[model samples]
Target chain A: MKASDEERRNDAVIIRTEGLTKHYVLGAETVRAVRQIDLTIERGEFVAIMGPSGSGKSTFMNMIGCLDTPTAGKYWLNGQLVSDLSDDQLARVRNREIGFVFQTFNLLPRATALHNVELPLIYAGVGSKERRRRAEEKLELVGLADRMDHKPPEMSGGQRQRVAVARALVNEPALLLADEPTGNLDSVTSEEIMAQMETLNENGQTIVLVTHEHDIAAHARRQVHLKDGLVEQDFLNEPVETSA
Target chain B: MLLFEIVMVAMGAVRANVLRSVLTTLGIVIGIAAVITMVALGEGAQQRVQEEINRMGTTILTIRPGQQMWGGVSRGDAQLSVEDAIALRAGSDGLLKVSPEQQSRMQVTYGRYNSNTQIMGVWPEYFEMYDHQLEAGRFFDQGEVQGRRRVAVLGYNVPETLGGTPPELLVGSTVQIRGIIFEVVGILEEKGDAAWIRPDDQIFIPQSTAQYRVMGGRDRLNSIYASTETPEELDQAFAAIDGIMRREHRIRVGEDADFNIRNSADLLETRNEANQTFALLLAGIAAISLIVGGIGIMNIMLVSVTERTREIGVRKALGATKRAIMTQFLVEALFLCTLGGLLGVAAGYGASELVTRMAEWDTSVAPEAVFTAIGFSAAVGLFFGLWPARRAAMLDPIDALRYE
Candidate 1:
């Protein structure tokens, strides 16, 4: 059953991490990529993680995305103790619960937009017929329906990013993870991508974006800023409106 | 991914660089072709030897004069004679037929063509032993042999040497051997070559006629050919002849026989064994090429895995398991090998045919060789494809994704 307006305030939290820590060994030197931190992200919330280089934002996003495990802490994704899962089990969790969107729009160079969008569902064991239908819907949702046959190299940067977005949404995952989504785009294309993000957020799609630019981070309703591998400031902002 | 999808992806990777894929599989193709062609040649030679044995009669045995050594081999060998054949015929219960044969080399002229060739003289039973076919006219009968008539049966090639005339036309021609004229009474059909012996090259005459007329009434013979009614009776025939010869010649026990016996069936077995060994040697040498082809696949696959590192990472990020990644690469290698194998089989078939056409070498391609070659090629693919697949599967997605 859909949650009514009264139960919206008690919406289930989709991502929760307690004392998550990531440490690296570089030839007798210890680098803490992520320090002990507790973070909770509720469903349908549009959130962004802001940090400079070496601030551990990417590392933190990798943990939340189930791409890497927390070294000595607990991670509960959709209420599962994912920190203790094996690499294969973590892969299952990543496939079923997360859809990653990289900054460079990491579409397979040789595959068409349609095939690129079908990749996540392919890993999920979805049959080709249904996979095609769902991928086409996601491409239409991201306004790249006409570019289904185009390869990444054939598309412009904005179109490529949209195809990536369609691929991310095709699986209907629990969370959308975008790392520096607009770092490689010009201002006009960035605004266009941010507007698409806003539309997705308005449709109650949960988002966790990682970016260094404040203007890009401003697109998310909530921002978690990091410094020295720890959360420095967490606040809410009025969402930037890009009319065009 | 589904099996077809994995195949499609692998095929796509191969198709992306068609030239490299073809060149990489060239090693496998050459390897398989070599194996098949060699086996075909060996098989062809074996069949030819077997046919020669069959044609000569498996139950047939030839007895040749054996040498006797005395005081460091100063003594001469014991020679076979008509009396020995008569003794063998009378004493050996297992003997079906015994024939005494004599041979002499002399120049023969029919009209103006004169050539020196071996002329064989034998009993009427020699025709039965060799299963001779008359292309024209008739064989000189037993009456002619007893009467010592000057009659000869021309072999298939004798007419060619005499006048390049057809065998049928030479049935009534007169051939003079060593200044004595003999009438050609029959013409034997062409038997071609068997192993190294050319049966078509010699003419035949009655033993009595040859001894009394040509050799001045000599009674000695060059060999004695004996045969058994059935193949199972050959050993008994051999033993009976040995016993009779020993008693007739007054040889002591444990002494070497005065003649050597050669069974056609045993020769056939030896030749077949030699052919088998030759086939094995050829296959062993050709297998090296398959291994070399496998190495080529491994090398190219390793390069492919490296080149597709980023794509592999993306697939892993999109939730592909290590098994899926591994299977994708393995299927790719399998494709390369099986493709090579098929091409090799075709090439092998063509090569064998080419050999037959160009050199007139008898070549037979056994179906088993084709199947074995294809099967081995697939195995090579699986074996060589393993390392690169495991390497791709074991790549850390996080590191791979970050790789340029």
Candidate 2:
């Protein structure tokens, strides 16, 4: 049966969070890392969550990425109630719906760029041929096709980040969650990597990045600034001024 | 991706850490070699003993006229006689060959050189029936036995002591036995010593000469050597001999017979039992080395798990399952053990050969030992590897990724 535009629009509500909160105990005192907050993310949305250090951005990102559970709230990803799932089920959710990119470009040091890209596909149970094919295509999209066999150490910082990006896209997940995706790279390399990510987001890939740099956050269509573990500002980016 | 891929990944991991892996497997190699070589040595020694016993003649019915002591059979008096031998041989049904031997300590003098040696009086057929080969003149004829000729056949040691004299000269020469001159007629082949008798130091003479001329005792004979037609007839032959001797000696059925019958098969059995015990002891010692090898594997695996904490974290973060992580490390451990087992098998063969050549030990590496070592090493890999593999698998991905 062909789905109508209304059904497709309703499917836009890919990830939803209601009063999500996380608390941790340090010695005898409880530290509320993520205060109660409500958030919703739609499919094909490019979102940037900007925050200062220790502002609970990482905690919220972890919960949203399914790497952690919210202490006092519910999180639903792809219509599944994720906060109530077992560890294994949560891991499956992360594998199927959430692709994470760390600031350090956490590609396995000894593994080839291609192998790094194939990791998510490996967990998704893609056969060897399909995994290789899809990983090659992803690396090609990230403009790292010629460097597919290079290990992380052999590649430049920008190249390594691109490989990480390719790995994040390999599973075709609902959200690409990047934590300071270019934090360690030089300005030129960081801009080059950000351009590739912008291209991906323009092609309808949903991306969520945590960053402190306004220049890097400018690539996203929507920005959510957080301070003191609460949302301080939310805004939309104007259309790219091609004629300027 | 799959189990096979995971195993391949593990193998690649071991290959990357070649030196560490080899060092871990060294213990197993030594253990396998020790077990195989030690067991082979024990088995070889036992076979030598059994061969010695078998070559000493068969179906030996020893008639000792002593009484039993506290749970032990004492050496009886030499009350056996030629008449007893004749009676048993003539009356037995399955009798093929029988010889009553008398042994006495005497001085053998050839020219001016005199040596103390055992002088044995054996029948004419005793030499040939016992696998004895003559390196010189023929044995005494029937005429010489019936005539009670004073003749002696020198054993290997006696002849050597005589300055390697030619067999013909020794045959015709007169050797004084107990101050009486006895002509040498035949020289028996070199038969090595049994557990009790050193044949090379003994001289053989006719039973007539030993009993009537030299011993001057008519009623006593030493132990008798007998053989049936075939090994299968030994029991029947022994029964017939025992029955005849019992009847002739007038021993009633209720009384214990005046002899004990010892068979070559029994000697072989004893030797086999000793060999089995020796083999077990050797295997036990070797197994300790294998355990040591297993410990080495465990130790190295423990270190590897710690060192690869970051890598494990990355894999976990990348969606590798706990089972996949566990299987990867376990396969690496198994691979290490298998390498050790292969090298140990080669080392065992080399060691066995070295022992055979250098120490003159009879060493034969058994195929069973190879298979056993391989299996044991694999078991050790699995057994000792589990804890480390589990540790790798159970690590928290977040904490592991954070490990410096």
Highest DockQ: which candidate?
Answer: 1
Candidate 2 chain B: 10-residue stretch with minimal lDDT: B63-72
Whole-model Cα lDDT of every candidate shown, in order: 0.87, 0.79
Candidate 2 on B64-171: residue-level lDDT in tens?
Answer: 454433224654542566777778667775365777888889877788788888989888766756767777777786677789988888787687777667776787
Off by over 4 Å in 2: A1-13, A17-38, A50-56, A69-76, A79-96, A121-131, A212-214, A224-244, B46-67, B70-100, B104-118, B123-129, B133-176, B179-202, B215-285
Give the per-residue lDDT digits (tens) of candidate 1, residues A144-204: 8899999999999999999989988888888999998887899999999988988898898
Docking class of 1: medium
Q: Give the per-residue Cα lDDT of candidate 1 at B206.
A: 91
Evaluated on chain B only, what are the TM-scores of all the candidate structures, in order? 0.85, 0.80
Best-fitting candidate, scored by lDDT? 1
Clash list (residue pairs), candidate 2: B66-B76, B80-B221
Q: What is the lDDT of residue A225 in candidate 2?
A: 85
- Candidate 1, residues B1-404: lDDT per residue as tens digits? 47778999999999998899999999999999988898898889877877888788888888888876453463577878888888888877546688888988889998888999788888778878888888899988889988989999988888888878887778888899888999999988888775545668888999888888898887879889999878899888888878878887777678776778888766566657756776677687678888889999999999999999989988988898888899999999999999899999999999999988997767899999999999989899999999999999999888888879
